[model samples]
Target: MMGLPANRLFCLVLLFLFVPAAVCGASVTRTLSTAEPGAGEVFTVSLSIDGIDLGGVVETLPTGYAFAGTDHPDDRVLVRGQKIGFAVMNDTAITYSVTAPASGSGDITGTWEDFLDETDGEVAVSHVAVDGIETAAESAGEKPAAQEAAPRFAVVAAAAALLLAGRGGRR
Candidate 1:
């Protein structure tokens, strides 16, 4: 009886040893061809991800950018709005072209979730001058120009109309 139990325990140990370990933890990186890309200029952006499963990567970029092409044409790519997801195995290297918007900058953001774990990170894209010769002046905590200017313009117009009405009444 003792020998039979020992033999079963030995088999269990060998079974555990032969099983492949699960891959844990994932890392993602984003790189741009030019440090500063101008409007309408298509630049190359590459994404290298490691330690992932067969279908566990999702990437998101801000508006005004589109996926021109990719290195791994075999890999499936799905895009919705600003987000892109991939169903791939293990590791992958993707090089794609991105056309900058008419104005401003775009940042890359993504999250990876698999049966193993979940991770997230962001990549800040650097914007050069429109001419591509100088860096644009950017203020810390300042919002995008297209988004910031609209509300302020409405307020200024309303104030100007009130002032003009007061002047007309005085006249």
Candidate 2:
């Protein structure tokens, strides 16, 4: 028979054994609705899943921001006396409303943790960042009070340190 030799058959079996280990699931995609917001403003974030269910999901909002609202079924859908509800959208989109406080800049951060059937798989983790909101004071022709006084404070501190050092040297 035109077949693999015994040694080649062993190698083929080993290849099949390692194939599943190398295989991975599709990557999850996470996106934001906007890149920036004004301070103390509310922004909408849309989370989309391409190959997973829309349940058993928990999203963490950026620090100093609060979860304002959600666009999903509120009532718990029941099946056979058990609460069966869609926690996340599968092959669909979900939107969460959040409000950022009046601080921080450069990078705003958040996270999403997704699970399948409530207990069938490990949680999928996704992270997101937005350019943080800028304050009105920053936009106007004025620096933050601390920043404005930084140089003056540094000079005053240096003067005080020098005076203390001179007194100590005399002793």
Candidate 3:
């Protein structure tokens, strides 16, 4: 490692640390189309799964909500004990819409399970809250705020430091 250049060593270190974790480990992310959903209104919740075959998924909707459908239709879809399940395979993302029932607040729980071996470590669970039911403000349908600009000072400083180091080494 000492014989390698600084940038090369950094790249090697990062590759060794992150590549296996990214390839072997499964990751799940959940997103809500609307944070505040009004009662009896339809909303979309999406789950993105990576590095897994994604054999099945279970979602527990809030008391006042019901699963409408998914982007990918499944014949074996079932609903029991306030939980919905569907069989899927090799899908990168599954998006489903749910209808909010009478005006109320509740939580949605979701879990992803693998069909094959558990040793592959392909499982994830997530929960999201549904609030602001029956609110006049929520009915207005407010969108999320835009992201702020990232700071450029660090990039410029790094470039300057690299230039100075190069010049000093050349001297």
Each candidate's TM vs. the true structure? 0.54, 0.46, 0.55
Model 3 misplaced stretches (Cα beyond 4 Å): 1-24, 119-171
**Clashing residue pairs, candidate 1?**
none
Q: For each candidate in turn, give its C-alpha RMSD to the true structure in angstroms.
A: 22.8, 21.4, 9.6
Which candidate tops TM-score? 3
On a 0 to 1 TM-score scale, where does candidate 1 land against the true structure?
Answer: 0.54
**Worst-scoring 10-residue span by lDDT in model 2:** 76-85
lDDT of each: 0.55, 0.45, 0.59
C-alpha lDDT of residue 19 in model 2: 37
- In the range 70-163, model 3's lDDT, one tens digit per residue, is 7776675777756987676787887888887666555566666565634222123332334553334334654334322222433344455555
Error of 3 at 92 (Å): 0.7
Worst 10 residues of 3 by lDDT: 119-128
lDDT head-to-head 1 vs 3, winner: 3
Candidate 3 to truth, TM: 0.55
Candidate 1 lDDT over 4-118, as tens digits, reads 4454455445434432222224555677787566777778877777765654556676556666656655547777777777665665666667676666654556555444444
